[model samples]
Target: MAEFKGLSVSFAVKQKQDVQKQLFWPNLKNGPFNKLEDPVCCVKYCQSVPNFAVASGFQVEIRDPSANNAVVKNFHRFKSPVRSIAYRGLGSGLIAVGETNGHLSVHSVAMRTELRHMTAHTAAVTGLAFLAGVVGGGSTLSAAPKLASCAEDGRCLLWDVSDPQGQPLMEFDLSSASSSTSVSAPPADATAAAMDKATALDASQTDCNLLACGMINGRAYLLDSRQPRPALVLSHEHPVTCVRLAPGDNALYVAGDCWVRALSLHQGGRQIAAYRRHHKHVTDLAVGRGALLSCGLDGLVKVTDLLTYEEVQKYEYPNCGLLSMALSPGEADCLVLGTNDRWLLTRRYESPAAAAEAAEAAKSMSAAMKDPYLKAVKAYQVMPARPEDVVAPGPGRSRRPRQQLDQLDRLLKKFRHSDALSHVISKGQLKRKPQQAAAAMRELARRGALATALAGRPDVHVAALLKFVLHSLGNQDMAEDALPLASDLIEIYAAPRELRARPGIRPLFERLRALLAREIELGKQSAMCLGRVGLLLDTSAAAGGLAGSGGAAL
Candidate 1:
């Protein structure tokens, strides 16, 4: 069972078990991106209005969510390509646009005219976001709004959009700061090294003062709006493409290359965990109610548990590389994805009839295992007995020396052949008895229980057995004894292509491959040395035979 807060839930209860659903875009009635001019660069949802904005080519189109059949005429066009777009706040219709020409423009959606235009960056601006407090809630729109933007020039600029005539409120040279303060500098290509540093930036939605930026050279920096210097820095092997601060402002989520990593800000920026399920670059991430949503260039959208880091759901869109993603604030299950194919796809979770069928099946399974003795036996076979379950000596009582053995005998009689062997292997390992475990494994192999276990639930103990085999093979004394068992187990468990592709199993395959290669080389060298020794022995024997013949003749 797993506990969350003060509530307990069964581990068998999958996150998506109750919500068996399919995701489809309802707005694709007229076809995907039929009205948009070109491929989408970015997408964002507006809070004040029931519409969404998409930047395609050099135009930013604002469309009504209630009517997705046609595009609205209310859009802002720029002379250069619009790389990024962001809304100021909930009640404010101000839209901020960043262009590839290093130009930043603030426009009013109601007026459909540019209010302020300035050269905020020397290169293309890649990211734009407003401070969390500047948007949402019931806050009045009377105060000036602050916007953060990152550009290819390696600079993160802060602007007071309210005063267009004034200069930038703050400027942070990410490239210079990183070069001077980074503990270990990352290797970069000539072009990337020559470019101005910062590549991406995002303001935290929970804390207005917190901001995060990613550099082209695989570094992520956390910044405080009140301070000029960075608060913390993180490095990755691949270029950092995106960085997002969680809603609590204590966790930072970063995506780069083919990985998504989480860092705990409260723990001085220690990495909490990393998820590498995506096959390509993870382009964006959105924090939902209790899950983290990520989209990648592999056209996979994965939903992972924030606490456990377990992937709960996955959606695949073949041949389409996702570049941007946004979750609807009004709908927890509603998600919008901007693709390289020039389409804005929206997905919403809807319950299906399969959920009812699954529930019925689970109920039947529970009913079948209702017998108390059978249930106990099944449980013992699946898991090792607890330490407290062993009968120990008490005050004024003599300890039963064979209590565990007696219990094992009773279980062995109650269970089937295969089941008994599995129980012995599991319990022996837990009890830290190597000889007992080896004997159980041998019995299982004799009865062909290894194949049965692999087919039934390979995830349960297959990895454990694999690790044990590898350890034994590494030991010079036990390698010969463990060779046959290791070969049989690997042939059964590693035969499936899908099983080999699993994240946990892939590393084991790599290690096995390297170990086998080394052993083959050593075997060749040993064979050559033995051949040389045989030649020397034959020469000495022939010489002794000639000497003996000479002595006999004399």
Candidate 2:
């Protein structure tokens, strides 16, 4: 009998490079009620409303995205610093905030008043989120929402906001279960007991029925609000900074230190994949249609494919450490990022074809607006002025002869370093020829002419050069030669204290740091391999000597 088998199919996925347009709003340097003590901690877009909320220091500010001016109204003020914020129930006009003083407050957007405030935790609240499909249904618009908050105290609490005086509906003690077992173990097996204790605490939830809490002790707990104990635990080497549930899927994405891991909720909370692209702690994550967007202290915003687990696009801002990120609920293409310096940036992606068409149209319009007389002269085949046509030089200096003047003009026509670099980049027309440009720049660096060429260039040109050098340093073929040159160039053009504080300088330094780290890690691994090989060779030689002695004795 013939047996049926399933075939696995795989395809090479081509990356999409979309043209991104960015806009920056003025920094919100001051909080609504007081001077901000820290950068904005959280920014959340309302799914059913036009406004978004930003939390910083002791206040939450609500701002309209469509407004022409950059003004934020003081929505709610707390006694302690607001560490995290989340919007509850679509179009419910309700916002929830967690504070450093371990207090949780729910505020009504339309009423502009606190609906309820409770002592939610014993320590600083690290995360706040509203469970999906728990409130805001039917014709009544006043349904109470359920909230989940986690804290440095290693506990996650679930609260029902139906009554102002009610206590937390449930609490998940992250330390209790594991601590008891370790305490009962024998002293001789202390190490084994500690390991067992850790394994017990690292739990996570696979379904929406449970809330995942990332603890400061490098463990994530999944609490079933209906049950008194945790349902599952997930462990990490570094403290878990953030936890997010994938929309419409039973998967969780956790970010801590420099890594982000995807875990399956249904498969006993097993980790599916881990991405370590960011060089610093991942500050925030926003999941979109088929991609996950992450921002980090390294000043990079990366979009990773959910299925392939590969980075599709990366964006960096100079001197800016991204602290928060939010995707517009109405538009997936619109993303708002908050920086450490209090600048809120919006990035919108447009179709590459459309951008190209717009550029072409603008160029044609400019050409048509040129002097009509010059256009007519060109159309009639009139002879334009040439170097040889000049009879005499201007008042600056004495002119020798037309031939000498022409020779001087020819010398001047030779491209400067910056101009030559630009020409090489543009030679491939719409597509940039990066390899050709990199080769030309490498030659310039070798001749010690790159610095002279870059001396008076605009900031944009310098930024482009920095990007090129970084990319070259990442190439295995060019890295050995490019590393020193790249370092020198960055030190000269980018390392000044004031320059490093510029809007775009931080990311370059971060990329350089990441490259250096990779080099160091490679060197360490190579050394370890060499040591192992030597040990094996020495062992073989000793065994051979012993065998020869034994044979001679026989």
Candidate 3:
């Protein structure tokens, strides 16, 4: 290995190699999911088997991601649109489904039959899970008959599927609790509203009796079905989109429209940490023993380490928004994704060692490869090689990208400032291309001739220039170069009473003034925050120094 600045480079090289081996390459497993008619809302993997399920168009589909010719089972007895699906735990061969309308269904996988149907709620069912031994003062897994379901009206119902009469075991109205009571101090106007819907629910892996229910109006209700009310209510600023309980820790993750926050279960759902990279709605979350996986409408799938609360890896697919995803248990399997465009995608993950072994095996068995038509063949020239018949190739060429720059430079050299300005920045009359024309303004500003250039422009040309500068000032990347130009333009145009008196230019100048004032206020706030942070650092350093001196004296 080569040394950089006389330092050994072995560690950095090894790190890079490890990263390459861990990277996952994605490929389309099946094209658009044959006969798929609607966007998928849920993709969940069975805890006891390799089969995964997808909810789409009032139907629930079960298939294996690792097989190209896997048998698929569909539940076709739904009377309403399906929203979410989950396999009943304990290898029970049962599945529960929630519908867009307020209804629930339970089906036996082997019998291909509906065991129990529920119509207890009057709004869209958002969350569904089984509470095997955690309901009605508790029982064993085989004897616990309660299945929990919640809907948009914030009503949670526990149904006894085994009781042939089909009556619910208990019902809890989570909306009755104050939305912000769990905090030390909350907003004055915080109250429970009738429309605040229940969004998601999950039970603790270690203590199955504890449940967390997420609501649409930014509240999370911690509940124990044995009681009649929520244990605690946690509040956030955005609607809770999804929630996942950690298997090994007393904490849970809640995803909202913007960020995903981790709340401490032992400390009454207080927010302990958060992660944010998605700029749109975070749609779903899946928790494993050691990692947290999230997919969002921004088309990003993030993998995070549960122990450190740090991002491990992320993949961004710009063309499609992901609605849900399921990670198979082992690395040998593949990841299944449900997209907003009604497409099911899957791809396998391979480590470097596994990939190399596969390559060697294929090379030794090249003669018996499946696609024999793709085999490499020996080739010979059909015609005799002749230098005279082959004409030398000419250099590839295209029109110059900087032709506009040349035209602007020629106009500037002639010192026709107004025509040069118009040559680049006019979108007047009907249409415009200010970007193509910004070249003229940039050159004029560099020469300190912008004032002279703008002296006698008409309303149409002035309007276009003002609009471009306004748009540029709002963007961070272009703001630095635009700041000084904007200052000079405002001084020249706004100070002139005659120009301000004109109807077209007056409104434009007022908007510029408002933007400048807002930017100034924001800058002041940023400076104040920096000062406070600096003071905090200084205080911490002084305390550390005094402690060191005391330790040395002792």
Candidate 4:
């Protein structure tokens, strides 16, 4: 039987049993840290990092919360007084401490390297995120992780830690001053409609590649790193206090004075949903499992299910307000609450669905890894004797195994060209350079018989035909004969959508354009040759026919 407590006891059985257990400071018996200060701002895990640190200006004493009687491992200066402490996910891994002075230091538990320090925000590093994979088919555990920091300065920096030097991979600046643009002289009433049209056009073409940033004046802008500047700017009724990227879709979730809004990743950050239940300013918002947790000066921790944006649970904390709140590494039914008093409280609750889902997930992972491709991929990962050995791994000038060749052929036939190309390239069966591939394609096209064989119904396209010819050409190089046909491809750009774009055509257009620009000098040389009396000039040939060229001419 599962036990329930508080007001939640009446519906205890309906909730799932959460597996994550709460262990107090360092898992010690009567630990070192206790009373929190004015407002607790942050909490995070330390086990994933080597030498994790936490700091807050509070009286230090540790108390054990676990029944296992675990011995505590005290951190160096664990009881030190500081302004605030912010923890990234996976506490055992890495931790960032913010001092009253505007500075942040990243400490790693495993490496003996010195603390990597950067003075970024003047006030404090308000929010910190370690960029672990939530999208691109990666889970928290499986994805490669990087460090991301958000500051009171309205700046976010993504640090590439894979490179020991900690290179800056991307950056987002939140402070964008509004610009004043004079209305250009236009037809009186049409000016408004024209501006709207221009706005829509720009929005449609915009790409949101960078994380969204909130401005001081309450506007949020979505930026693409490849573009010159921000792609979209969204206005808010009040200054945005907090923002986060959704785990699944990378959609922007922002909390402002009294509203928590979800903006679409597509359509240039258009508002998709907004919640208006919070009567006061929203301080921070955290997402976990299927629910969103928000804290405000209202002393409320509002839990809303993501699916419906409806309030699922509300708990009042014993403080003026919570500065920050975070979910456990396990995303458990419990939350690590940071209140204005500067103490971190671990509160547990009953949510049966969350527990059952975790069990199901555990069972699924316990099974053998599915996906046959990964196994084949692993077998192919061994380093060959030489780079060239990839193609002919075992012997001299070897051919690909019949089965593999058939697989490649079938993939190409099914229009899975990228995969087929990837497999061949991975195996080193084909050369990687674009030029080599182009030459091979041309040689294949010269073979008349191969073209007839591939011109099948409903599937025949210029691209497929060109690739077929290129494959048939094999090692032979025939650039001269291929160049003419390739040049004729300029007209094919507007070809039907069903027709694949052939490499043969584009190269031809490029070559022809170059020749036309230099035709005058070449034509002068041709005229000089005709005047030497060594060559007979035919009037009919000049008229674009061979008929006059063969006749007896003076």
Pairs with backbone N, CA or C atoms under 3 Å apart (clashes), candidate 3: 424-437, 427-432
**lDDT of all predictions, in order shown?**
0.67, 0.62, 0.68, 0.46
The reply for model 3, stretches above 4 Å from the true place, is 1-35, 69-71, 89-92, 132-145, 176-194, 329-333, 363-554
lDDT of 3 by residue, 1-554 (tens): 00112324478765663453355433212222433678978887765578888888878888866565154678867888898786654434667898887788777765667877777776678887765353221122335446777777667777776776666777665645443322122123324434467888776655656777888888887788777578877876679988877765487788887578888888887776775546457898876535677888766677765545656665655456789887775442566778888878765665667878989998889756646344323233245769898656546544445645466668778666656776676434113644444545677777666655564356677677777778877878657656766776676556554453457878887888899899999999999999999999999999999999999999
Error of 2 at 78 (Å): 2.4
**TM per model?**
0.58, 0.58, 0.61, 0.43
Residue-level error in angstroms, candidate 4, position 350 = 3.8
Give the range where candidate 4 is weakest over 10 consecutive residues by summed lDDT: 196-205
- Model 1, residue 127: C-alpha shift (Å): 0.7
Question: How many clashing residue pairs, candidate 3?
Answer: 2
For candidate 3, the 10 contiguous residues with the lowest summed lDDT are: 181-190
Q: What TM-score would candidate 1 get against the native?
A: 0.58
TM-score of 2: 0.58
Among all windows of 10 consecutive residues in model 2, the one with the lowest summed lDDT is 20-29
What C-alpha lDDT does candidate 2 achieve relative to the native structure? 0.62
Ranking of candidates on lDDT, top first: 3, 1, 2, 4
Clash numbers, per candidate: 4, 12, 2, 40
Which one wins by TM-score: 1 or 3? 3
Instruction: Output the number of the TM-score-best candidate.
Output: 3
